[model samples]
Target: MPAYDQTRARVEDYFDRTATKTWERLTSDAPVSRIRETVRAGRDRMRDLILSRLPDDLRGARILDAGCGPGVATIALAERGATVVAADISPQLIDIAQLRLPHDLQSQVTFHTGDMLDPKLGQFDAVIAMDSLIYYTASDIGAALAALEPRVSGPIVFTVAPRTPALMAMWYAGKAFPRSDRSPVMIPHAHPKLMSAAKSAGVRRMLRPVDRITSGFYISEAMELRP
Candidate 1:
């Protein structure tokens, strides 16, 4: 397989194995939480931030929740009255996501197990790809953005693992001594490169860090791209 495909497959395997725990880390504040409460707090803040960036009301909007792991945000979008197409690369994650949808709101969400680059997924009024772009390299992100631009009528909101000097050093160290429990690979994306890609794709808009201290390392800036 090609490099990008191989990378994608590895990510699929990682998420598949950790789907349940990942969903808990993202949306729950249980007493026995595995991750830090601050981390969960940050995620909750980021989700609200993305929602705030979207239209005040999403009723009847056709939204694409790219890489919608376990469908936390997918169900949230459906509750807001959006017809959501929640797509994930891992079938295991998709199954978990589908299972989480409320019976009444099940009709509002269509789950698909596929890469975000799939062309036949159709178009949407808006696209949200929260916390999912971290797996891709800069070039892959550019290509994915190019693929998504024409399909979206409104803004594309997504997050990335930012490439700062400190984070770069940590990333290299992690690569040199990777833990078997974590994802096999993690690529920190440069803000400049992301902006360049958006410019090249003719969809450049706004970019800002989600949190000052955690932005460039733990979490990242929320980018809004428009066509």
Candidate 2:
């Protein structure tokens, strides 16, 4: 089987077991609407940062939301008049994303289940993979990015966590968090090196901070990929 399929299976199992609990934790601090509002606030900020860094405008652009869990950000972009394709490895998550959208926004958004690295998605104007690249190794991440670049006519916006001592401490503190891996944890993304690798793949880099509290986290840098 392809590595994407294998990773998909692992991620599916991880979410099947932990999604409910994670939802509960997120919603524990706020009601559903409030949670959405808070998340939207952060997402809008990240989107704005991406817009500022990117050379092209995303308004009315075709967008691919890679690993778009629950489609929160996808729906947000759709609301802003972007044609959005929300793709996730988990069908269950895609279903949730579809159900979560209103009829009008649903008309503007399309949800699909597929591996992030798959080349069959055709092409898009922009791609956004927020908080999703942590599931792969460095080589896998590069492969995924390479597979993604041709599809993007404009730029790519994604986030990666910095690998620092403070970040390592945070990961250890949250190590008990549910994981599908039966073996050692994989550290796939590193911020400084990721920018270098992306540059090698024919994408110019721009980055900024994403302001959200994530578990097992370090500094989250929002990246802009210019071709």
Candidate 3:
């Protein structure tokens, strides 16, 4: 297996080559109308969930989305009247996201090419990484939590795979979804120390739920960074 850093770069490259196609692939199995509704609903729910955890009003809050992928969440925040800065490592993904959004809403969302570990991002009322943080190592996750700590003025919501060694071993060793570029075969392993790092970083709210919503590959949680 490739080292985490190398694999991270490889995964980014893989997405860059296939970002436009990836969204289509992810939505292919479902009905087109249902897919749209699901995605919109999911993004709205995520926005509400994140905003509810915040102290500042979200009507015009400045929100930053790290590794925003195709920018669905970024667009959702913008639609909710937020000033969103969506950053991704892949410019191609950002392009697609930009194209998907409206011209007027375009002004509300500024897409940038950047990584989570970079120090140039400055700060925001909330920093949401969604599923992108799965690309980090234990130390990387810790560093990410710490890096966003200063920038996070209100809350930070992130998701990851399960933390159990058995699940991690299975994902790292088996393939869940056949014929998917996602390498259903190889998935990121969540670290136990992440919870500690989050708490130490002043995260007051934690939601850890292991269920089908995660597609049975891992558990999904929302860590609310308080203060």
Per-model TM-score on C-alpha atoms: 0.85, 0.73, 0.72
Cα lDDT of model 2 by residue, 77-165, tens digit: 78677888888876777777777788988777877787665677778888888767765565566556766776777777777655666
Ranking by TM-score: 1, 2, 3
Candidate 2 ranges beyond 4 A from true positions:
1-5, 24-60, 173-189, 199-219
**Alpha-carbon RMSD of each model:** 2.9, 4.8, 5.1
Per-residue accuracy of model 1 over 124-204 as CA lDDT, tens digit each: 999888877777776777767777888888888888776777667877877776467566556777778877765665555
Error of 1 at 122 (Å): 0.5
The stretch of ten residues in a row with the least summed lDDT in candidate 2 is 209-218
Model 2, global lDDT: 0.64
lDDT of 3 by residue, 1-227 (tens): 13546656766776777555755344235344554555545544554565455444367788888777777677777877888888887777777778778777988888788665566767788777766766555455655677677766766766665466555667655554454455423344444576665556554555243222232333344554455
Among all windows of 10 consecutive residues in model 3, the one with the lowest summed lDDT is 209-218
Positional deviation of 105 in candidate 1, in angstroms?
0.9
Model 2, position 119: C-alpha lDDT score? 74
For model 2, what is the error of residue 22's alpha carbon versus the real structure, in angstroms, after optimal superposition? 2.2
> Which has the higher TM-score value, candidate number 2 or candidate number 3?
2
Task: Tell me the deviation in Å of residue 156 in model 3.
Answer: 1.0
